[model samples]
Target: MTSTVRRAGAFAILSTLSLVVPLFDPVTAVPVAAAVLLAAFAVTDGPLFDLFAYPDDYEDGRLYGLITFVLAATALGLVSVMSSMSTAVFVGTVVLVGYGNLAAAVTREWTDNPASHAAAFCVGATTAGVAGHAISRTLTGDPVTDTFPKIVFLAVAGALLAALLRDILILYDDPVVMLAVGFLCWLLAELVPGLGATEIAVATVVTVAVGYLSYALGAASVAGMLTGILLGLLTIVLGGYSWFAVLMSFFAIGSLSTKFRYDEKVDRGVAQENDGARGSSNVLGNAAVALVAVLGYAASAADLPLLGEANPELFLFAFAGSLATAMSDTLSSEVGGVFDTPRLITTLEPVEPGTDGGVTWQGEVAGLLGASVVAGLTYAVFPDVGLVGAAIVVTAGFVGMTVDSLLGATIEGTAVGNQGVNFLATLSGAITGALLVLAVAVL
Candidate 1:
């Protein structure tokens, strides 16, 4: 009983400190608070996350958790600094970070009760929404523009809530249900007499219609289609229609490639899961990093002496590179499966066609061809990317493909899942593309 009391008291104190310290000293408080919360979770197992307790590996878990906390803190600090000059961006960054925590909490599948998740998400979202609004107003001294933070919070929280309710109520993935939830949320937001309700309603309608059409076209699974819609909405809100169009082009290329040898692939037993239909995991793995780049670009257009200016060019480079990697990987696997034989990428020894690390000349050529197509698309879409930028995109794609093969040969099947491998490859491609842009600007 004493132990429980002590733990509870500690948590209360830490929670208070977390809230208070951030107000006075944000830089120090962010990481310290994260560590304290992680420690609290490890000690008491968290009220809603007891099943996640690691009694057997407490020390190891604590160490890893602390490391993650530190990394998160560092990232938050960077964002804070980058967005310091803009009140809207500053508020958005803080709220986005808080939203991440809410997401993590609510989506903890180990929790027994759906009600608990919903309650926690609602409370967290409300607090974050109110706090972001207040902060933006305080910083800008302009109530008019400050409303943006609240709207952003509303969209994000609504989307998350919709996802949670879909799982609990519908109990299955359905595009129609998800889109309905999204549309309803937007309608409610607009009905309250705020920013041009007609415009918001029209945009929402068009976006949802496009998403449904994509689903009917068989470009994505139900879950994938919904994910794409949500992601697209957010990106369009942050960037512009052109940016969203560039993003959709990637999907078009990737989906078309999956259909290239569809029947043969199924017969060879090497087809993508679900008849080449992508899911939410695939969408996120390929495009999440690009979305982050978009956010960064939205936050500031500052010039990093090393990375050049944060501009539309940089964002498109990241977008194209990641999509290029996804295209390369998909084309390689689907088209390469049609080859007579493949050799292990690492050993050069002949292996089964479907082996994780297997490669073929035909597949390699197809992968490059796919990457080049993305480069052309990127160059055409974003006028900022010239012929040199196209080359850079192709190079990044090739590099990512190599990384994918190396990881697959060494650890993909043994330790990491296929999704993880895909994410890593796309991440590498984004990094490589960004670096090339920086190099060119510097030179």
Candidate 2:
């Protein structure tokens, strides 16, 4: 058999193991099975490795895909056993991972078209969702109608995420897709019970429209559009459209800033690459922290342990702060690069406009303006967030901008990339926003 056929067959056969999960104690059986698989794969010359591994696996001297799959399965098993997640959901995730990959592999062998691979994976995801729903209904005796919508939503989300990750990531795509799908299932079960068909439909329509509009505006590339859609859906579903608007505000301000003095920036060789069409990295670096804060706020609403104990409002503030920081940093770098002769932030020495860690008064003022815009939006969106909260967000944004400059001056190029500094700066802004909220409460 061809290597592709062998891989597909192996995935199909191994995925069936999920069917027997209900018969065994997942807590014990999962660990023992995982241990055995690890041992088997550890043997380089083993039949299991030879049969299941890919060409890249030989180059890496290990079965990376299989190892990731095993790890993902083990994680799902542990979550199922510990949480209120049903065994059927775990089975569904495993099937989705395996069958989805199998379908992709087979489709790839036939044709190299990306759209075809995505369609095939979606089919596999839908099949897994149906299987999971049937098993849940059969085992739990729940009304079929009760879980159908959520399961269907999960399937659709899994398909989108799988397609995006498969297209973007060079490795570990399957495991990440599995974990994301599993998390979505868990969220549906535990946190967002109100997310029925209507909410899903609305979220999809709004996100897709916004994503397309952004792409048309040349603010985002194809990958950026997909990432934005996913993140936009999560923000709307977890928080609300108002929160999503906050994110859009950042995107609008950043995009406009990049376009400001576009010709001059290009002449100086400081313009954003691809005329400021954001890719996946740019989207994730700027917005991931804000997304995490939205998730945290959702968890707080659901009263999930440590995250729950904190005031949910704190997360909202953090969300604003993160976005504010992103806008500030973008404006400072993009707008400042065109207008001012910059000085190094660490030392008072003149530097090129595009130089890392460069600072100019024009940039600082623009950064503050960017922060103020987001903070004003925050105050407008949430009535409870008074002037004090808005001021805190602005302060946090400025602090994050300073942090970014400091990091750029010190360790950015040597130890961490630009994205890492952006992430850290946003994280700092988030923490600052949250802490200031707490301080106000304490005082």
Q: Write down the lDDT of every candidate, Cα atoms only.
A: 0.61, 0.80
Residue 324 lDDT, candidate 1, scale 0-100? 82
- Tens-place lDDT per residue, model 1, 208-280, is 6666677778777666766677667656655667667767766777788788878887887887778777777
The sequence of per-residue lDDT tens digits that candidate 2 reaches over residues 1-443 is 57766776686667667665665556556665677577646767567777777778888678777777777777888788888887777777778767777777778888886556766766776677667656755655556576666666666666557657766876346678778778777665565555577887788788877877887888887677778887887788789989999999998789888889898899999998887888888989999999999988888988988564778888998999999999999998987898667999999699988888998899999999999999999899888899999999999999999999998888999999989999999999999999999999999
How does candidate 1 score on lDDT? 0.61
lDDT of 2 at 317: 85
Error of 2 at 441 (Å): 3.7
Q: How well does model 2 score by local distance difference test?
A: 0.80
